[model samples]
Target: MFLVGLTGGIATGKSTVSCMVKDMGVPVVDADLIARQIVEPGRRAWKKIREVFGDEVFLDSGEIDRPKLGAIVFSDIEKRRALNKITHPDIYSEIRGQVFKHFLRGEQFVVLDLPLLYESNRVSSYLYKTIVVSCDDELQLERLLERNQFTEKEAIARIEAQMPLDRKCQLADIIIENSGSIAETRKQVEGIIKLLRSSNHHIYNRVFYGGIFIVVLTAIAMLMYWIFMR
Candidate 1:
């Protein structure tokens, strides 16, 4: 099965692209969803987190208080790393398990939607192709502030915690520029899905998508050559 890794920084429209990809019939496994599941009440990850961070991070209803915890962890790199140490392995295992299930169930293509693909150092090892949904900083900041009701400072802090978009774009195999309208973004995703439905994830597929204009001209050349020879 072809596995495509999808990732981006906070509020960069990665989820939007994932939705579009899902609409195109490609199966998607969300690492963020799995991470949240692993840390829900009664889960081992939840127990470990509570044991380390105490009940202070939980609500009276017994659920994790994400914003409270984020306030703590995001302010300190050590605490952030500590939280990562607790959650990352469990999150990774669940993501891998789900991806394997999809493969076993005979999916032609599967997408691994991750928020920290590069930060976790899993991109080069697990997937040959990574799609980074990128938008301008202004757009990203605007979206984050609007969606989360966060102040600009608060949104900037969250955005800065992740790898910079420039670095992510450099590391990615392909990028879907999301600064434009939703229709524009969906158009890009649609084109990508149509191209991927046919084959495995290899260097050839990479070149086909990455060098699309050149590949198109080459295809036309080959077609003309065949017609003339005939």
Candidate 2:
């Protein structure tokens, strides 16, 4: 399957682009969805988080209070890193498993929708191409404030927590500027789908298989290491 990494800064309309990609009949493996799934109350990641963050981050009903946890980690860099250390391995493993299933099923292409794609970095080397959906920072901040009902300061803090939009644009193979109408954005996404469909399939297959091979080996090694350390 042709693997594409899709990412952007907060409030950059990346989620809209992901939905567009999905509507076009190609599967989009959502990192955010998988993230929420892995953190449900009974999951191992949830237990690890409770152990590190304590019961204060949990709800009365025994679920993670995400906003409370977000208030903690987004304000502190080290705390955010600690959280990622616990959650990211499981997230990546699930993403890889889903992608592998798609590859085996002979999918023509698939999108990996990630928010912190560049900050994480490891998945970048494995994708055939990367798309960064972006808008001007002023608009991004405005959108963030409106969408999440956050004050300007809170929105700015969240934006500053990730890599800059300009830097992400530089790293991207394709940049979708979401500064216009929804129709305009849809046109851009459709154009990308057409381009990917027209591109050489063999090249994509080579890159995907080569990348997934290393991913499988690394995952196996890490699992063994975790088992031995335990």
Question: What are the models' TM-scores?
Answer: 0.85, 0.89
Scored by Cα lDDT, where does model 2 land? 0.92
Lowest lDDT 10-residue stretch of candidate 1: 198-207
Looking at model 1, residue 149 earns an lDDT score of 91
By summed lDDT, the worst window of 10 consecutive residues in model 2 runs over 200-209
User: 113-186 in candidate 2: lDDT tens per residue?
Assistant: 99999998978887888999999888999899899898788889999999999999999999999989999999
Query: In order, what lDDT does every prediction score?
Result: 0.86, 0.92
Tell me how many clashing residue pairs each candidate has: 0, 0
- TM-score of the candidate numbered 1? 0.85
Model 2 clash pairs are none
> Which residue ranges in model 2 land beyond 4 Å of their true spot?
202-230
What does candidate 1's lDDT look like per residue over 114-226, in tens digits? 89988888645757578999999998999998999987888988999999999999988889999999999998998888777755554454456559868889999999999
